[model samples]
Target chain A: MEAIYIILAGSLVAVSCGLVGSYLILRKMAMVADAISHAVLPGIVIAFFISGSRDSLPMLLGAGALGIITTFLIEFFHKKGNLQTDASIGVTFTWLFALGVILISTFAGKVDLDQDCVLYGEIAYVPIDLWITDTGTIMGPRVLYISGSVLLVVIAFIFIGYKELFLTTFDPSYAAIIGINTTLWHYLLMGAVSLTTVASFESVGAILVVALLIAPPATAYLLTEDFKKMLIFTCIIGIIVSVLGYYLASYIDGSIAGAMSTVAGLIFLVVFLFSPTQGVVFRNRRSKLSMTLNEEPI
Target chain B: MEDFLYFFSFQDPNIRYVVVGSVLLAISAAIVGCFTFLKKRALIGDAVAHSVLPGVCLAFVVSGTKNPIYLIIGAFITGWLSLRFIDMIVRYSKLKEDTAIGLTLSVFFGLGILILTAIQHSGNANQSGLDQFLFGKAASLVGQDLIVFGSVSIILLLVVGLLFKELTLLAFDEQFGKAIGMPVKGLELVLTTLTVLAVVTGIQAVGVVLMAAMLITPAAAARFWTDKLTTMVFLAALFGAISGVSGAYISFVAPAMPTGPWIVLVISFIAMSSFFIAPRKGILYKQFQQRKYQKQILEENILKAFFHLGEADEQYYGHRKISDLISQRRFVMGRLKGGLQKLVRSGFLKQDREGWVLTEEGKNKGQRIVKLHRLWELYLTEYLRIAPDHVHDEAETIEHIITPEIEARLEKKLNYPSVDPHNETIPYR
Candidate 1:
């Protein structure tokens, strides 16, 4: 029964990331999401210093605000400084992450966050930190509550703003010409990304969060061309990898997030080499078959 | 101050290894990073840094020891594989380079975590310091580690020194290198191999986490100071060595602090300061240039205004009221007053009870301004086919910047026109 709760918690985080990540992959801004995931470390540390508790509203808000600021700083460097997009993203995130690490080390005793948690995360302990009501009712894991709420928020954002997001991601100039607020949609997507990263940070550390955010959508991208199908495929891949990764970690007594990301990578590798239409094997086989057919005609 | 003295005095033999190891690591990474930075493959360094984790872990698992040599070999192999995979993905798939890098980096790091945690769970005591590879612990710089790092660093430095011209050509123009039959692909392979070796060599000092910073930040900071390849590479290595030694010393003073993050923070500070303060290309330098241009534009505009005012009257040296001059140009009162004072100080204008007027020298200078403006307008209209009405704004900007040589060329090209396209007189000097 506890295993069921853990699976649910992992799936919620994975699906939320998958939903937001689908848009990120389509926008060709997967790296910005990676930047946000790492940049939020300083925000989390500062939030912990203020709240003095593992669970607090200030932590979430701080992470959200810093995530947006990370976006703004990357844009500033990429535009104002005339840097390559990857370079700007690289410079900003590494600086923020280094600062966060320094702060964590300096205040090691005061801060509940540790370097290990920042890297591999404590998702297996999620089921242990449960929330109980006044009536002695077990309300499942609190992480499930946070991550599930974030998933609903992300789904609502995508559902309500689907047309605007689609138009902006595919053709921003056209969206602007048609009177849609393209910048507003962009910030909205970034906002969803920040919220999703914060919600998932506890379940998967900063490093593996990048994998969850990129791998599923990237794999689904190889399998399909339709946008809607891509989103669905990413969610399915995300949930399966989460469950599979949990069991793999349990079997090997390893970090659940790491195992999950490894599983996600394995899934991508499979799709990369063996997808029916886009796989290298099939593409090669098709070419060979065409050659043989032509030779038979001769 | 005492701690600083003790660190630099090198009284402790252990400290000597750390200082020497860090400087070598810094030089190798920075020199290799210069080429990577110039090639616009900066993020590949990040990918390689992260991808080295599995190699380190596998090296430990295979050897059953935490030896630096095996770990470095493992790191190089995986790091090289990551780059090859990235190139292959970009060539074959529709996904972009950033996506491929993010994917490969995260996947390899995740696998490393899996192996590392598995090793930890097995209750292996030797695996205690293995976690240091993640964030790096420079105090663990044993003599053997320093030897490996130092020798590899020397090899990297020598290769970069010998092939300086070839590497520069490959960085700036790959097509040209190929056109010249310079074995461009083989040179690229050598550079990639060196980048992997540099990152692997530095992993024990800065750790896998911040190795990318060690690799790229010094080169990036050095870019602000020079345009020449040799100068940039040398400056980058110097900056790298400085940051590395200082960072190692910092950890010595504050025993609790990690050396990798300190080095990264120091290099980041250097890069940020360079961005704002370096000569020629720094933000402050560019701002100064812009301000100078703006001031020159104001001075030339004032002279042109005086010339226009004098053109209407038969007496070219007559007095004009300060209020009249301000109204003609419609500049703010404060700025106009400052310009008038500056002209008077330079003996170009005089301020008497009547108001303001150009001096004998000022009249000649003002006439020259009007002549350049009208000449540019004529050049724009007659030669460039611009309408006479559209040339004023163009001439207004060009009048301040056109040197006497360019002015002479314009005169020769336009056959020394007597008037502009607007039929205004082209005053002679």
Candidate 2:
């Protein structure tokens, strides 16, 4: 029963991250997403201090706001200060993450969070932190509910804004000509990424959230060309990573989130080596075979 | 107060070791970071930093000791591998550089965490301080650790100094370097090794996570202050050393405070301030330059309005009401009031009870502007062959910017034309 809850929670977080990660990779904002994941640490800490709780609306709101600020700062430095994109991201996220770590150390006694927990997370505790009703009824794990709702919200957001997101991702000028608010959608997409990152942070930690957010979508991208099909494959891969990672963690007696990300990496490596159309090995072989056939005909 | 004095006094061997180690680590990282920042691979430092974790854990698992040499060797191997992997992925696959970097960074970190946690569960006694690599242990720097840091710092500095010219060329233009018969590929390999070494050594002070800041923030901050490569490198080293000392001091005073984050925070503060307040390229300075130009354009446009009113009635020095200036051309009322006052103060316009009159100096100034406008309009239509209707807007903008030399050249080039494309008289001094 504990294993099921943990796997289900991992799946929900994975699927949500995979959904958002698809757009992030397509838009070439994967590193920006990585920046937000680390940068939101200060926000989470500040929110935790103010609200004095682990899981609350204020925590998500705080982290979401910081995520948007991170995006704005990166863009601002790039466009206004003339800093390169990579440096701007590096400077901004490290500063914020450092601030978060300092805040944690300052309030180490009061805050239940630790630096190690912030890095890899405590997904094994998902079954332990149950949500009990005021009427004395026991509910399922709180992370499951949080992650499930986030997945649903992500799906609805993508579904409702599919046309705008698709057009903007593929062709921004055409989207602007058709009067779609590209900037608004850009911020909105960043906001969704921030929210998903905050929700998944508890189950996967800050850095591993990046793995779930990037690896599965990247893997799916290699397997297919269609965006919708890619998203579906991402979710399927997410589920597989969660289940395999959970067992791997239990077998090794290590961090479940860590195992999940490792599995995610392994899956991507396999797909990278074997994908029929895009795999590096196969593409080279196909070119060689074509050259041979042409020579034979000559 | 006494603790501050004592910490800075460097009387204790522990404080001396921490201070020297941090400053050395920071200086080396900052110097190498300038090259990486120039190459526009700033975030690659971050990927290498995270990727070193697995190598670190594997080294500890195999060596069963906390030897600094072994740990750095392990970290270097994986850090270098992560860069290779990112390059390979981008070269072979359709994935962009960013996606490749992100995938490599997280997966390697995840693997590192798995191994690290497994080692912890295995109950190895030597694994006590191993987690310090994640956040760093600057305050706990002993004399033995200083030997390693000092040696690494010397190696990094020596290589940077010896290959400064080649590295600069590699950073600014790799293709040009290759065109010049330079071994650009070998140079790139050397720089990559230096970057990995810098991160591996610097991580002991600022930790793996904030090590990127040590490499990137100083270089980025120094870039804002200068355009010269030599000056920027020196400034980056200075900024890095300053932050390193401050980080050590901070942990010294506040025993519970971690040193790595504080170092990153101080450097970030410096970088942020540099971005805003540095001269020439700074945001604030650019805003000031823009405002000054806008004000100049505004004052010139107002003066041109008076010149137009004078041209209409053949009264070059006639007094005109403020209302009359508005009737000729629209101006923001508040800004127009300020512009008119400024014109009067500069002796361009004389204010009287009835209205405002152009002074002798103001007339020449205004006449020069009108001539430039008409000359540009004629030049555009006659030389460039633009339509008469399209020449007005072009002249309107060019009239404000045409220097006296350009004005004289335009007059000579247009053969001293007295009439513009629109048949307006071209006033000349």
TM-score of 1: 0.95
Off by over 4 Å in 2: none
Could you say which candidate leads in lDDT? 2
Q: Write the per-residue lDDT of candidate 1 for residues A48-140, one digit (tens) a residue.
A: 898887774777888887898888877875664555676667777888888889989988999888988888888888889888889999987
How does chain A of every candidate compare to the true chain A by TM-score?
0.95, 0.98
The sequence of per-residue lDDT tens digits that candidate 2 reaches over residues A90-109 is 99999999999999999998
Native contacts kept, each candidate: 0.55, 0.89
In TM-score terms, which candidate is top?
Answer: 2
- Tell me the DockQ of each model, to 2 decimals: 0.66, 0.86
**Residue-wise C-alpha lDDT for candidate 1, range B354-407, written one tens digit per residue:** 878788888888787789999999988887899888989888777788888998
What DockQ does candidate 1 have relative to the true complex? Answer: 0.66
In CAPRI terms, where does candidate 1 land? Answer: medium
CA displacement after TM-score superposition, residue A174 of candidate 1 (Å): 1.6
Question: What would you estimate as the lDDT of candidate 1?
Answer: 0.86
